[model samples]
Target: MKQTGVAILGAGRWGKHLVRNFLAHPDACLVAVVDPYPETLAAIKDKYNLAPEVRLATDWESIRDLPTIEAVVIATPAVTHYTIIKDALNQGKHVLAEKPLTLDVAECLELCHLAQENQRQLMVDHTYLFHPAVKRAQEVVHSGCLGDLRYGYAARTNLGPVRQDVDSLWDLAIHDIAIFNHCLGQLPVQVQANGRVWLQFQKEFQVSQLPVEKEFQVSQLPVESSEDNQGCSQSLTPQQPANLPYGNAKGEQPANLQPANLQPSTPQPSTPQGLADLVQLTLSYPTGFQAFIHLCWLNPDKQRRLGIVGTQGTLIFDEMVAQAPLTIQHGYFEQNGSTLSLLVNIVKFLISNHLNHFIQYAIAFLTVSACPNLHQYLLVWVGAQLVQILSCLSQSLHQGGVPVTVPQLPK
Candidate 1:
């Protein structure tokens, strides 16, 4: 097999995992690892025992133009995505960007157009969509095994590694939203959201109610540390993450890394002044299916769970469950059951364990390199669609939980 030469643009937590997977793949030749932090690159090099033939650099440009490098894997901040991806596509390098494609929908579409024009494959690493469990859930939901769709709910929360560049809505909600759209088979048309900013902004929760009365409450906890990508720095600093090329202590861009013609005159805010640690989202699909998502960075209860309730039963995808991460319970509803009781919920639930779907993601890029047309360009569209929903959700959340309509993708 002719190896596809690849370079990883960010070697942070998530990017390092990409590095590992790409290295393990027989068809991928990882030629370089790029990040602003030298220590991060050094750590990756030492950790992987990378060959001297592979390049390591602080700037992607230094290595991107290499003759051997045919593609770039981008796992940088949302703010930097537009500039870097635009550059990569313009240079005719196939790109595998991290989620949200870009913070803006227009940028995403532009990149999509650019990729098509350049005849290059542009994909986003929406890793959750690659999960075997999610794939199984998709089969169950699409096969009508779950019956008439009623509603869906997902909760993603963590104690720390909260990012300083973007909020939980930007960081955590994308995973669940991607899953929701995939299983539901359509993008959300409308969104109603509100958020609480505590760890980053320290603002009081501007409480709002969903149409239906909800009965739940969580005690807020606060922590101060800036870290993490698709999910960053060894020391979680402000905008100065270990993976991105953020300027200085004051958050200025280095002259070398400044956006050229490819960048927008005014880039979107890297960190919102009202950045929320917790966000409540209600996504309304065209089929009248609504999925509620709870996103939080201050909570210690590490949860990666999503459920779609149909007339027959619910399809549950819970990563925390070791035995069976994906399951479908047939016939009837069970309510008011404590979270712990779910472990012993009888023969009705908990599907078999899934393979490491994260590695499967690496194979996606290699496959794209081999056959761009057969490559599921839907992944790119899905990434863009998620960004569209997120853009609407951001507006609605900041407006005191008012409902916002998610935009339809332009033809």
Candidate 2:
């Protein structure tokens, strides 16, 4: 087997982790570590005890044209992703970028076109899509075990770790969104969101902020629009659901399921804050399934929860809940109107494999050596779907929670 030559750009908080992993992988030959901060590079080199053959550089230009560097793992800020990734893909080097591929949808589309043109791999670091629990949840959701799926909800909240570059919605929301899209096997046809702003644009801060998140807090999941999936409308061209971000290597779309209609909602003013300290969103799918999402950084009680209510039971994924990370609460007893007697047992799916999600992602990346088409796998498609969703949701959030339609991606 031939080794894939790789270069890791940015040796910061996340970049260092990539250095450690690539050093251990049997198929990856880490050729260089690039970052503007020299001290950070020195620390990683000393910490990892990198081989002498590895090169260190202050900028990508020094190594951009190097033939030995076949791939680049970028962990830089999102704002800088387009330039670096564009260069890498153009140079015929495969790329593995951090999440939210770019700040906008246009750039992602352009890069997707470039990757195809060059036949170079471009993947995102959406590790949650490869999570053991999420993988199981996807199988369960698509297997029809849940019976007529009713609706869904998820919350990704924590206390601190905010970033100024992007807002809480942009920073945190992609993870849970990726999970929902993966499990449900469909993209939200429309989304509606409203937020409250406090720390970012209050008496002390400026009001000229765009999509704010005080620190770097990324809310887990969302596809929320309208009230309980009402008020939004769409005339379906009757197309197959967009490809799941983590679908098969050939980029196959989901089963041919008839999608729902999307009605547009008037943009209405929700209580005006600055950048929302909290956000409430709803996602309406083609199958008429709706999902409500709660996002916030001010809440002290941290939570990572998502669930799908079905005719049989509710399948849940609560990351904070240690004992039973994934479970199903059967509503087997009896039901009266909306109320139900839940005198039933809960089914737990404890992930026994101790391998971390990133490790799993790395294994997938390495597999690209044998399977070139693997680039079209998981994060590549998932990242695009997420960026598109986030881009659409941003409009709804800024316009005071009007339902906005999510456009279909090119197949």
Candidate 3:
């Protein structure tokens, strides 16, 4: 096999994982590792025992124009994705960028156009899409074993590694969004989002060692009580005034015991302008399938789990479950002549009209089930999706700058 010369940009954190994977692949040749930090480059070089042929550069510009390099794997921050990917594509190099192709949707579209024009492969590193558990789930869905996918819910949370540039949505939920799109074989038509700011600090703050009462008092409420006061009943009641204009016989306000005007001794710095630490998003698909994603950076324990619900069965993928990460519970409801006979009759009538459609669906289900290698088919399916996007973009390009219909899966 002809080896593809590849250069990896950014050598810190996740970049090192990409470096190891690319190096392990037989078809890839690590030509260069680029980063602005010398310590990272030195660490990577020493750990990987990089050959003299592999060039280490402080800037990507040094390797972007090199003809020897046929591909660029970008693992830098989301903000730098646009410039680095655009430059790599412009240089006729196949580009694989980390998720959220670009911070802005317009930039993402432009990069796709550039890649199409250059006839290069433009892929986003939705690593979960390649996971064995996720692949199995996709197979289960495609096989119609779960019947019709009604909805999906994903929760991805961790305690630390809070990013300042992008919020929990872009940093964490994007993975689940991509996975949902890939598994459902469609994109969301509408999305609703809600988020909250739990922490004002830019860096991750440790709350494990600090006393819970003290931390909560400092961050959340202005509780003016001594450490000896174990509960609110002990301290809050005595702090109330003995007599009040709108107080009851017990001297407590009829409405509620409102806290006095208590403020922090020192005003904490304002929260930096950045993404939210907690975000909840609900996506609606044209097929009437809905997905809910919950992401948080301040969670006590790390969690990565997805649940898929259908009429026939339920599928769960719990990454934390080491013994059995993927599980399917068979379930189905049979409609018979009961108290709700009228509803059952109506459902039967509706299903009768769609007999032909159901037959075609059944054929597809059997075809998928008969396939010996589902993983290969999934790869081809993903590739086909990419090709479809490129084809649409190429048509748009030929039509003189009309907008291209980008696919739902980030890239």
Residues 222-250 of candidate 3: C-alpha lDDT, one tens digit per residue? 22322111111111123334221111011
Query: CA lDDT of each candidate?
Result: 0.67, 0.67, 0.55
Predicted candidate 1 versus true structure: per-residue lDDT over 1-411, tens digit per residue: 688899887776667767888898887888888777787778888999999999988887677678888888887655567888889888878888777677778788888888878888888877666666777788888889667999999988777544445667876787888889877778888898876654334322221210111111122334333222341222224334444442212223233332242121231232234557678889998999999999876667878788999877687888778668877777755466553222223233444422245555545654554433324534477778787888788778777777787767984
Estimate the TM-score of every prediction: 0.79, 0.79, 0.65
Off by over 4 Å in 3: 201-274, 333-411
Candidate 1 accuracy as lDDT = 0.67
- Residue range with the least summed lDDT across 10 consecutive positions in model 2: 227-236
Ranking of all predicted structures according to TM-score, beginning with the best and ending with the worst: 2, 1, 3
The weakest ten consecutive residues by lDDT in model 1 span 208-217
**In terms of TM-score, how similar is model 1 to the real structure?**
0.79
Name the lDDT value of residue 230 in candidate 3. Answer: 12
In the range 227-338, model 2's lDDT, one tens digit per residue, is: 1100001111123122211100111112332122111123224543344557788999999999888887656667789999888778889877765689977655487898
Of the two candidates 1 and 3, the one with more favorable lDDT, higher being better, is 1
Every model: Cα RMSD to truth: 9.4, 12.9, 18.1
Separate clash counts for every candidate:
2, 31, 0
